[model samples]
Target: MARTTGSHSDITGPRVRAAALSLFAQHGFAAVSMRQIAREVGVQAGALYNYTPDKQSLLFDLMQTHMSDLLSSRDKLPETASPLEALETFTRFHIRFHSERPEEVFIAYMELRNLEPENFEAIEKLRRTYEDQLENILRAGVSEGVFKVADPKLATMAVIAMLTGVNTWFREGGRLSLEEVEQIYWDMVRKSVGA
Candidate 1:
């Protein structure tokens, strides 16, 4: 990677990344080009190399950043909270977080096939960590007889899929507020677990 020459590389670097992420989300990663990303960022083509080694690195950065934010944004549920409470918390969090970042969510799912093998594995690991949190909650519910989930792992995947699907057609003013969407999804999740 080339060292950034300009003092404004600090600002320019993020702008470059933002441009890359936006373009990658709109046009598939394979269809986008380094020069296009540079053009979007209003930088010379060579200048993009100062911020990233290659376009793949830019894609990896966007994916890793999104996963990191998803992992860190989850607050630990209260120690004394019941299984149902923990489940509700996870339901609401998944919906709210993914709904707020439609572009990131879209790219995260849509561009996984474009990732290099190692980058793909890293992203998958981070996603699995998030899945494990919900699976554990489901397991706790099953142990407590509060949920009749036959398979915690499958239930976790299903519930997450159902919740994340809200981003596809949900607009803020399109008949349902975000809170209502969250509540509706939460209710479906609650019933899905047989709680």
Candidate 2:
């Protein structure tokens, strides 16, 4: 099908993806219909096909976009000197990045089961790339005797889980500010690796 004309064309694609992301985050992928997404986007059910081939494609696109953004943003941070500095940077960055994107983070983790095998593989590849960033830091720390991580791979997984878990309970106006939370978590991560 030909694309929609005029300014509407530019915005419709993003709008559709945003609507689908919100819906899929609230209701599982299996539970949300294309029509529901179209309704949310203020477009006809058939019109969604102009932007996405089908629901599965839309789901894959959302996940792919989220992971891509995560990688791109991470790559832009300034390089740190020591492995300890890099690990602290990674810890603070993960908490801040994942916290701001609660919805995307939720769908990224919860909706993985809904992706087809190939799509799942692709998303997992991107995820591993992100994880490897931290794992490498741990390995360097261990090599330099700055950290005592027996298995960098296992330490990577644990640190990521601990940082990501902040999203589940953190709020803007609660007891601690996000900066404070970042510091507290960084301290815990530092201790965990024996840095």
- Model 1 over residues 64-99: C-alpha lDDT tens digits? 999999999996877999999999888889888998
Query: Per-residue lDDT of 126-176 in model 2, one digit per residue for the tens?
Result: 999999999998998898999998899999999999999999999999999
- lDDT for model 2, on a 0 to 1 scale? 0.92
Model 2 misplaced regions, further than 4 Å: 1-6, 75-80
Candidate lDDT values, in order: 0.90, 0.92
Identify the leading candidate in terms of lDDT: 2
What TM-score does structure 1 among the candidates reach? 0.95
Q: Write down the TM-score of every candidate.
A: 0.95, 0.95
Candidate 1 residue-wise lDDT at 94: 88
Query: What residue pairs are clashing in model 1?
Result: none
